[model samples]
Target chain A: MTAKISIRGVTKDFSVRDHDEPFTALHDIHLDVRTGEFLTLVGPSGCGKSTLLDLLAGLTAPTHGEILLDGVPIEGPGLDRGIVFQQYALFPWRTALANVEFGLEAKDTKKRERRERARHFLDLVGLSGFAERYPHELSGGMRQRVAIARSLAFDPDVLLMDEPFAALDAQTRETLQEELLRIWEKTQKTVVFITHGIDEAVYLGQRVAVMTSRPGRIKHVLDVEFEAREGDLRADARFGDYRHVVWTLLRDEVAAARQEAPVG
Target chain B: MHLLKGLRRVAAITLLAVVWEVLPRTGVVDRTFLPPLSEVLTALANLAATGELLDHTQASLGRSLAGFGLAIALAIPLGLLIGWYRPLADFLNPLLELFRNTATLALLPVFVLLLGLGETSKIAIILYAAAWPILLNTIAGVRGVDPLLIKSARSLGLPAHRLFQKVILPASVPTIFTGIRLAGAYSMLVLVAAEMVGAKAGLGYLINYAQFNFRVHDMYAGIITISVLGLLFNVLLASLERRFSTWRATS
Candidate 1:
């Protein structure tokens, strides 16, 4: 299968004040994101999972190597790749409808058409009644829903999400995860999601790539089983088993990451 | 409870008016120097009947609005440009800092000398005094736009100009309004001073004219008129701010 995104020999570095050597974020990373698949990257805190997502979003460039989209090198941010940040980053000045219509406006869509598409995406995210509400007026989960709708309304080839539900409570997280799966099934859009939650990684990913600590590298890629259905996947024994499997691989990495320069 | 609070404010204002009328009439202070409120009201009516107050008020209002509008037109675009393009800001910061630090009213003599004792110099002084607040606040407003908003917009392939229009401009509105309000108040403050320097009409000239003629009541009328006009301008600006800033916490 042709990969929608190709990452090869990617290394990221950060320059610190008064330090001669730069901090390494990702060390010689290699991965292929196959088309139309949900790939979750799971790792310890400071394992650079968010950094990797930022790279895919083209917010920052890797110090070495390159990322490819459709055989074309990704130089910087483009419309073909959409991103949902962890912070919900919705413009406070814009209403939920205007926020959803953001990408459409960038594409220079007609006002009437933009409104229609925005409404459609809001309905997809189950937030149809909140078209006029501002970001501050909405609940945390609803705001994230608007953020997701915004990413999808643009109709990008790939969606890169950076721990989008990390701020939500347990009930909201589970609901959003299920909603995400349904959206994935309906849209069949290629997704690359980053998370530190073991069960979240296990349940959501078709394939979960576990990473080692600082100067992150993929240690293992586990194929997950089970159909994404309506009921809670946490109840399934296989889901529990996958969670255990990922936790075992990730525990040492977590400890090592927590000890690694304290992620200043 | 709200009604009680409103009543308190009304009672306070009424009490102040009573003191103003009674205090001077009682000779606590000279009646001519600090005329009774009734005499001042009578003088205000006389000035209005003779169209002196109207002409002076119209002149002052026109100068302030003209100068304030000029400042807004020049400052907003320049501030956004400086804020967005770092190299341009780098080039301009030293110069801007030097000028911004200098007292704006002190430049009045130079403006009057160069532009002459006309509306030009008065407007010029008001613009100078008014520009700094708008310029500085606009720079802050543009710079303070949430970085994530810009990043997200860029990732969606928004070009620079569209990014400014969509994200930067709307985000800057509240702060820009803050600057505009400051400029509005500053325009009145500086325009009055500028008018005092040399002007045939306006509240400042009227007050000076009254002082020379020993018409203390007329001077008070001019003072009261200017205060009312300043308050009116502020109310108008505050309403505009409220109207545009419905989506966010302005305070």
Candidate 2:
């Protein structure tokens, strides 16, 4: 199968005040996300995972190397890639439906069609009754659901999530993760989810990419498999084994990340 | 429960009115300078009968509205630009800071000398005083927009202009409204001060004229009318703010 996204020799550098040389956030990196694949990237704090997602979202550009989508070099932010951030980031002035209609408005869809599609996505996220509620009115989980519906509303082919559920409570996180998987199955879009949770990485990703910290680089990519994912998957022995593998890979990097002097 | 809350709010005002009526009538305070509330109400009724009250109110309202409207028209757009563009803000920052600190009232003589003691000077003073709060607040509002909201809009391929309209403009509204409400109160204050110093027909002039003529009742009446009008204007602005930003939690 052809890759939906290709990252080759991607590196990012930040210019710090009073520093003789620019700080490298990500060292030379290579990765491929297959079409319709759920790829989770797990790394220590400050390992440049968010920076990588920003690159994918085209919110920022790489200092060296290129990222391609279906063989075209990603230049800047576009409609084809939808992003979900850790904070809900819902426009407080807009109702849930209006927030979901934001991207559709950019697409210049007709009023009727925009309303219809916005409603459909809200229903998909189980927030059909909350179309008129503002972001401040919704609970945290509901707000994130609205955010998810918003990102998916315009029919983007790729979803780039940067710790979308990281701020949520554990129960909400699990519920959203399951909902996200359900949505992914229905939409068949390529997804790259960034997270610090090893269990989350194992449970959600078809393949989990573990990265080293302090000039982050991919250290390992492990394929995750289980007999069934419907229920009790987290309780499964195989789930624990996969979780252990990811933890073992991340252990040294996480410790090293803590001990290293923070890069300017 | 709602009716009880409403009655509670009214109780303080009623008590104040009762005290005002009783204080001078009971000889607790000098009656010449401080008339009973009933006497002031009678003076207000007499002014209304002569149509002088309406004329003075209209004059004050017209000048205040003109100056306030002009300030809003000029300030909001200019503020948005300065807030959005760093180069312009940088170039103008020193000038803005200089003028912002200069007291509007202190420049009253300059306005009177430059424009002469006509309606122009009073309106000009009102505009100058009102513009600062609105303009500064607007600039602050634009700058204070959540960065994440901007990122979210851009990620959806919103062009520059649309991003401004959709995200930046709406998000800055609450803060901008705060500035506008402040401007509303300032416009009334500066207009009254300017009219007191000069002008033939406004409520301020009426009150000042009454005091000189020793029509203490009329002066008190003018004061009460202007106070009530100012309160009503504030209520209208607050309602407008609520209308624009209904999404905000009422608290």
Candidate 3:
């Protein structure tokens, strides 16, 4: 089957301050995201998983090579793709419903239709009654939920998420993960999720791509199969095996990445 | 509940009035400079009866408002552009700082020299005074907007104009209101000073004329009128700020 997003041999280099050598974030990265697949890119800090995700989102062009969505070269940000940033970057001026309807308005949908769709997605995210609440008025989890509804409301073919739930508490993360899974299943939108958590990678993704340290490249790919996994599916032995395998693949890279760069 | 406070204020004012009336008779102070409050009130009533006070009030109000209106029209848009556009800001920053640092009233002589001792000079001075606060505040407001909001709007495929309308404009509104509100006070100040420099009418001129002629009570009346006008302006702008501002508890 043809891939939904074709990532060619992409290399990203950033010029740092003064006369220092350019930082090689990602070098010669090749990945083929299958249609309607839930692909997770997992690695430690400085692995360029987020950088690669940015390239896919068309936020920045690859210094070398190119990214293609549905056989067409990715030019820049578009409605055909949706992104949920890690920071829960919801516009504070807009209410939850208006925030969700933002992209719909950008798409030039009529007023009544945009409101209807926004209401539907807010309900899907369990924030139906929070339509009038502003971003500052909502809790952290609710803000992220509004953001997710915002992304999904426009009906993008592929969803690019960069550690969307990394900022949430453990309990909220788990609940949102299950909710995300339900949304993914219901919508059947191709998802390219980036995270450092091996457990999270194993639990949510159909396949997890492990990456090397700085100047990251795909180190390994593991096809995960736990059919129709419920929210409490982590108790299974097979799920534990997948988690262990992912951890083992990432352990050395995490250590090497830590040694190379001290995190904040 | 609030009536007691109002009554207290009235009582304090009455006490001052009684002291002014009795103090002159008691020979505690010279009555020429310290004219009785009743005399000032009677002078004010006489001015009103002859419609001279109305004319002076209208003249002062017109000059102040014209300057204020011009400042509002010019400063806000210029501030928005300079704040939003780095290139424009870079070009204007040095010149703007130079103008902003110079005292507004000190240039009244320069304004009179160029525009003559007409309303133009007074209005020019008022505009000069009003511009700085509104413009600076607007720049600060727009510049301080969360960069993430712009990024979010861009990612949503909001075009440049739409982004300005939906995000930048609303986000900077509270700050802009702060600048404009402060400008009301600035307008009063500059207008009075400019009028004092050279004018036949306006509250400032009335005070100046009365002082030179030794009509001390009429001078007091002029001072009181200027204060009242300034207070009214502040109240107006404060209410407008409250109505237009979208400040929220969320941020």
TM-score for each prediction? 0.96, 0.96, 0.90
lDDT for each residue of candidate 3 in A1-264, tens digit (9 for 90 to 100): 689999899999988878488888999988899999999989888788888977887778899998989999998888988889888878776789999998998899999999999999999999999999888888788999999999999999999899999999999999999999999999999999999888889888999999998889988889999866874689888999999998988899888986875521
Best by DockQ: 2
Backbone clashes in model 1, listed as residue pairs:
none
Off by over 4 Å in 1: A227-230
Residue-level error in angstroms, candidate 2, position B77: 0.7
Could you give the candidate ranking by lDDT, starting with the highest?
A: 2, 1, 3
Please give, for residues B1-251, the per-residue lDDT of candidate 1 as tens digits: 99999999999989988999999989998887898999999999999999989999999989999999999999999899999999998899999999998988889999999999999999989998999999999999999998988888888878899999999999999889999999999999887789888799999999988898999999999999998888899999989988878877731
Q: Candidate 2: where is the Cα deviation over 4 Å?
A: A261-264, B1-9, B26-28
Tens-digit lDDT track of model 2 for B80-147: 99999989999999999999999899999999999999989989999999899999999999999999
* lDDT (Cα atoms) of all candidates against the true structure: 0.91, 0.93, 0.89
Off by over 4 Å in 3: A261-264, B1-50
Clashes, model 2: 0
Q: Across residues A1-264, which tens digit of lDDT does each residue of candidate 2 receive?
A: 799999999999999889889989999989999999999999999999999998998989999999999999999999899999999889999999999999999999999999999999999999999999888889889999999999999999999999999899999999999999999999998999999999999999999999999798999999998887789789999999999999999999989998987653
